[model samples]
Structures are given as structure tokens and as C-alpha cells.
Target: MKIDWAALGSVFGISLLITVALVALFTLGIVGLSRRERAAAQGDTAAVAVTGAYACFAACAAAVGYGIYLIVA
Candidate 1:
């Protein structure tokens, strides 16, 4: 059997890109939470930061769910 090198490379590249993007999204969420905590300690409210962090987390969850659905179906 012959290996389809081009198809294999394409899949590898897309997987790597998605992995990096997901990690970055999760990292931003963590940073946002830290910023919110810091602001609260200084007697200030960082509503935007908290909201953005939750949004990031939601996006990550959605992506993961979609991937699972694809595999199961």
C-alpha cells in the first residue's frame, strides 16, 4: 500500500494549529481571571475581565464538544 504523504501532512498541520489556538484561548481565560482577582483586591470591579474570561471558557467547551460529536457520529 502507498502512503498519501500530502494528506497526512495536511492533517498534521491542521491538528497542530488547532491545538495551539485552544491552548492560547485557555491561557487567556486564566489571565483574565487573575486580572479580575487583582482588581477586586484593590477595591475595584473588573466586570469586563470576568465576562471575557467566561466567554473564553465557553468557547473552549464548545470546541471540545463539537470535536466529540464529530468522533461519535
Candidate 2:
């Protein structure tokens, strides 16, 4: 039996980076929402926060969809 150490390591590294990035994005989205709640009392800032949060969420969804597509196709 033969093992491809290099390819295995590459896959592991890529997966780790992607997982970390997604987590960071999600965390940012949560933080943005929290900010929005606080900023609501101050006006326009809440709108910016809401927009940023939604953008982060959208990127996360896109990443998940792309991962699913890669697995299925």
C-alpha cells in the first residue's frame, strides 16, 4: 500500500484555512448585529452595521454552497 503524504497534508491545510475563515466571517456577522442593536439609538450607524452583517452572512452562505457543490460535483 502507498500513501500520498504531500497531497494529504495539502488537503488538511486547505480545509483548516477555509474552516477558520468561515468561522471568522460568522463571528464578524454576529458582532455586526450586536453593534447594530447598540447603534440603533444613535441612528445611521445601525444601518451601516446591518448592511455589514448581512454582507458577511451572504458570504458565509456562498462559501457553504460552494463547498456543497464541490462535494456533489
Candidate 3:
């Protein structure tokens, strides 16, 4: 089968962007979680927003990987 280089490149680029964004968001969530955990331990009122952020990041990252796999295969 002939490979469409342009389309492959576009898919790869999009996947890379998504992966990077997910990682950045996950890192931010981790930082926020650390802060929130500390606050909670100190008996402060910090709602658990980071957990949802982390879950979303995981889903996004998995989707990006799946897209990359589809493009490659």
C-alpha cells in the first residue's frame, strides 16, 4: 500500500501535540494534588479537582496513543 506522507505527518503531529498537552496537564494536576493533599492534611477546604484532571489527562493520553497506533498501522 502506498503511504500518504503528508497525511501521516499530520496525524503524527496532532498525536504529538495531544500527548504533550496531556503530559503537561497531568504534571499540573500532580502539583495541584500535592498542594491540595497538604491543605487537606492541614484541615483546609480544598476540593478534589486534581483527581478529575488526572483522570482526564489519562484518557487524553490514551486516545493520543491510540491515534498514533492507527496512523502507523
Candidate 4:
């Protein structure tokens, strides 16, 4: 069977895009967590909690996106 270079290229491109997106999202989560920790150390409970929640949400969103990418790709 002949190799389909075009199809391979498309898959590679999509995979790269997904990987970059995931990395960005994970980075956001890490940043959020760092901010939360700093706030907690500063005695701002409310701000710390909010930042923690946002980080959790970001992580969840990244996981969902990865699952969808795997399914479609």
C-alpha cells in the first residue's frame, strides 16, 4: 500500500496543536496554584480559595480537551 503523506502531515499538525494547547493550559494551572499559595501565605484566605478553585477548573478543562482530541484524532 502507498503511504499517504498528506494525511500523515495533517495528523502531525493537529497533534502538535493539541500538545501545545495542553501545555499552555497546564502552565496556567501551575501559575494559578503558585498564586494561591502566595495568597495563603499572606493570610488572604478568600483569594487563596478562589485561586485554588480556578486552578482546579483549568486542570479539568485541560483533561476534557485532551480526551476530545484523542477521540477525534
Winning model by lDDT = 1
TM-score of each model, in listed order: 0.97, 0.91, 0.55, 0.65
lDDT of 4: 0.76
Q: When superposed on Cα atoms, how far off is each prediction in RMSD? A: 0.5, 1.4, 4.2, 3.8
What do the candidate models score in CA lDDT, each in turn? 0.96, 0.92, 0.77, 0.76
Maximum-TM-score candidate? 1
The residue-by-residue lDDT of candidate 1 on 1-73, one tens digit each, is: 9999999999999999999999999999999999999999999999999999999999999999999999999
The lDDT of model 2 is 0.92
The segments of candidate 3 whose C-alpha lies over 4 angstroms from its true place after superposition are 48-73
Off by over 4 Å in 2: 41-45
Q: Give the alpha carbon lDDT tens digit for every residue of 3-69 in model 4.
A: 9999999999987997787677667667777777787788875566566658766776867887889
Candidate 1 worst ten-residue window by lDDT: 45-54
lDDT by residue for model 2 (1-73), tens: 9999999999999999999999999999999999987877667467777888999999999999999999999
Colliding residue pairs in candidate 3 = none
The all-Cα superposition gives candidate 4 an RMSD in Å to the true structure of 3.8
> Candidate 3 residues 1-73, lDDT tens each?
8999999999899878876887777777677678778888899955666666577667767877887898899
Better-scoring candidate (TM-score), 1 or 3 = 1
TM for candidate 1 is 0.97
Pairs of residues at least 3 apart in sequence or in different chains that clash in candidate 1: none
